[model samples]
Target chain A: MSNRDRIEVLFWGIGGQGLVLASIILAEAVGVYEGKNVVQSQAYTAIVRGGTSKANVIVSEEKEILFPQVLSPDILVAFSQEAYNANKGKLKPDTKIIYDSDMVKIEDNVPFKLYGIPFFKIAREELGIPFAGNVVALGAFSAVTGIVKLSSLERALLSKVREEYHEINRKALERGFELAEKLN
Target chain B: MSKNVRLMQGNEALVEAAIMAGVRFFAGYPITPSSEIAEGFSKKLPRVGGKFIQMEDEIASMAATIGASIAGVKSVTATSGPGFSLKQENLGFGIMAEVPCLVVNVQRMGPSTGRPTKPSQGDIMQTRWGTHGDHPIVVLYPTTVPEVFKYTIEAINISERLRTPVIFLMDETLGHMREKVLLPEPDEIKVVNRKFPKVGKEDYLPYKPADDDVPVIAPFGKGYRYHITGLHHNYKGYPTTQPEEVEELTKRLLRKVERVLDDIFILNTYMYDDAEYVLYAYGITARIAKEAVNILREEGLKIGLLNPITIWPFHEDKIEGLLGGKKKVFVVELNSGQMKGEIERIYPRKDVIGINKLNAELINPYEIADHVREGLR
Candidate 1:
């Protein structure tokens, strides 16, 4: 494997979108699969439902993580238009943007590369899953960033998710990986 | 060396260190900048046969922690500004009752919930005097993730050793920042458990001052019957109305911490030996001051940084030694002038300059360098 020092990830969504959970899963993946160090931070407001929350995770092969806030992200995933608009500028020059095209509108004129995935649609249509969009996003992130293996991401999800909803969520994550591979 | 270094945030490291320190009781409410501390501990506590309770409010949470501490368990609770305001009553109770507990105030922008989730170090004075009357408390301010881990363990040790409440005064910046931390092996680190009085119930005086003014505590249900209260009490644990009893009790309570100030105090000196300018800072401000010191050193300026991990009873002797014969001392903090006043009180004649920032953002290193440059002119 190529040895890059750190992988910075920015996961953005509304309060109810499980953005913090997605960041936690990513942190667990780095810790479990690659045995690398990970730092996860989230920003949210007092209002519970409609306010935007962003979880920024930084993974490094060998370094003590400091400054929990990500100054720049190599990978940016947005589940809402507001999240996209608020955080897209924080991406590094050559960073990748993955958004749920069903719920987000990405400007075509934007200079950086964009991967507009129908994450919500895939969760609902392909896997018949409704609340598994965050897991699907994580699957897509694992596939694109190649920071952690797919098996490890699946293990982390299984460990954290409720047992009752595990099956469809696992299917949703697999579908997300399939979709990302085909697009890439 | 374990070689088990991990990149963790300050909040995460606090939890990690607590686990390693055998902390089994955590009761806290979710308040910004400090909620992660609860979240982190909540998840890890169960894995280690510990309990994490999210109480209805900060007041109840702090009370619960004290209850657990008196029940012979290592306990802690974390909070931000407003929640800290709510916890002051119970904190005073802990001081009076001589409870071994840790209270972490992850400070945020605040007069009263000014900024729930933003960073500020304005609570230095509040940590010292928010509670009513005179009481001694050990307060340690950490600057980095590793220090957060180290000092948190130290806070627990001191609280247990001194039989008093200890404050891990964390700011939002340090609490939220991520950094690499080296975890010590299980056998390598020194751990201090609570000292239990060996005497039988008939002869025991709960408030009888032991050596070093630290009394051996007997847990509530440990079969040792003893009276406990927040009132001014005698060595025999009964409330007192006598003037001499109150005076002696009050003086010992304060002296327990004041006597050990030299042993528990610490400050970091960066290139201060032959410096012409001294920048004094703590918490997040210390990080920025170090950066400023480096930049000034690169420019061949005679500058140094004195970053204190122990904020309370500010390290008077060390400050004097470092500032020997220097005419200029710059004190930077996120608050208007909390610690600066302490520095001035310590060295009345020294040219103590205040580089104040209350903008809710951390003071920049460039500002310190500029102040030093201007002072030179």
Candidate 2:
């Protein structure tokens, strides 16, 4: 991508599903680790969990990230059917939609490029850590979009989480990368 | 460039800067968008040998901050719109008493609890005229996360140097947005501490003006004991109803800031040398304006930006010089034409256009670029 180009990503899901954490990891990877300018913002309900939560992460190679909110995101990662439904109107013809195959269902006639991954199923059944689904999604996003390196994401994740949880999260991320590779 | 770059939110930057500036006391009540400052200080202050108190309410928080400042500690209090209103009386007291302290208002939508989480520049005018008296105040608004960190230190320095209350105004957008900031090393940052009375205790006058029109304040518990009250006071700090004493005190308070306006006034200009259309903004709105200016510049339009880093004690001279030959000026804000009035007053000949957004939403870059396109056509 050109230095002037910016990639905008949106993570939408229930408040308990770790969408905010996913956005933070992505932003830190690109901004802190990769030395690119990034702006991350979120909108969530007042309640702690179960309400709609949305996080916007904009990564730009420019000297500044001028606008904090993403009006027309280039990539959308929806972890639930409610999130996908709520954000359908924001999609353009060239927008890329990444959804949880186990939770979100898209109509067949949609024009956007869609990638569905069973992040929840892999985290719970294979990894035995349901909370690791967000990391899995992050890995898939990095692999599919090439917006950030999977290695950088893992490093950012390890820096943010506790030492004891690092091994499981690393496995979850690798599982996601493998799943994305299979899809391609 | 200190390679210690970290992703920090605006609120977190404020706390970190305040602590670095020797802010040893923080008294605040939790309020949305501004609560992070309190929370961060709660965890970090004790480790740094500072104190953080969750006051019963905004009023108490303001009072406690002033009390701490009087005791010679660098103090701060953070709140949003409703809490800001509650702190106004004490804020005015701090002004009258010449207590050096920082008051951060992370502004959200409001008349009365309008939208706790949404961004707004509604407090732009309120921070200036909120208190019910004719007193001088310093208000600084930062447009970016790094600016937030830098300006917080500037706010504390100005408050200490001028012996007055400083308002660090931020909006919900900047308060919540996270960005990469190069954290400055301790020796790399310049810190200013309030000057203590140099004279013998027997000859010290608490309100006596020095060469800079600011009195050297002695901490309350110090040996140079003096009285302080919200009432107009004489040079010795005794309450006085005499017209001459009150007028002299008020004029000195105003003159201290006014005379040094050139030093305190801060603003940034972009592509303004040959521009015909100048956009004036601050806080998050200015960030969008910067992007809009870049887009318009690419499209071969002579558009530029003038963002006020210091919102109060208006940068009249700099703005007048910057808009010398500009034909039209656009004032973009998240309020209903608040700062636009100031622009109109300063540049009456120019057609000052106001692009206002008050719907609890941010004014996007596209909206501004489109507005400029339509206006040009």
Best model number under TM-score:
2
Q: Candidate 2: lDDT of B169?
A: 94
Candidate 2 CAPRI level: medium
User: Tens-digit lDDT track for model 1 on B1-377?
Assistant: 12386656788899999888878999999988888899999999999999999999999999999999999989999999999999999999999999999999999998997987778888999988999998786789988888999999988998888888999988877887665578889898889998888898889888988889888879999888888889988887789999999999889988988888887887788888888888998887786787788778888988888888888866667677767777688888888878878878767644888888888866666667888788778
Q: Tell me how far the alpha carbon of residue B59 in candidate 2 is from the true structure, in angstroms, after superposition.
A: 0.5
Predicted complex 1: CAPRI docking category:
incorrect
Q: What do the candidate models score in CA lDDT, each in turn?
A: 0.82, 0.90
On lDDT, the leading prediction is 2
* DockQ metric, candidate 2: 0.59
Per model, kept true contacts as a fraction are 0.16, 0.69
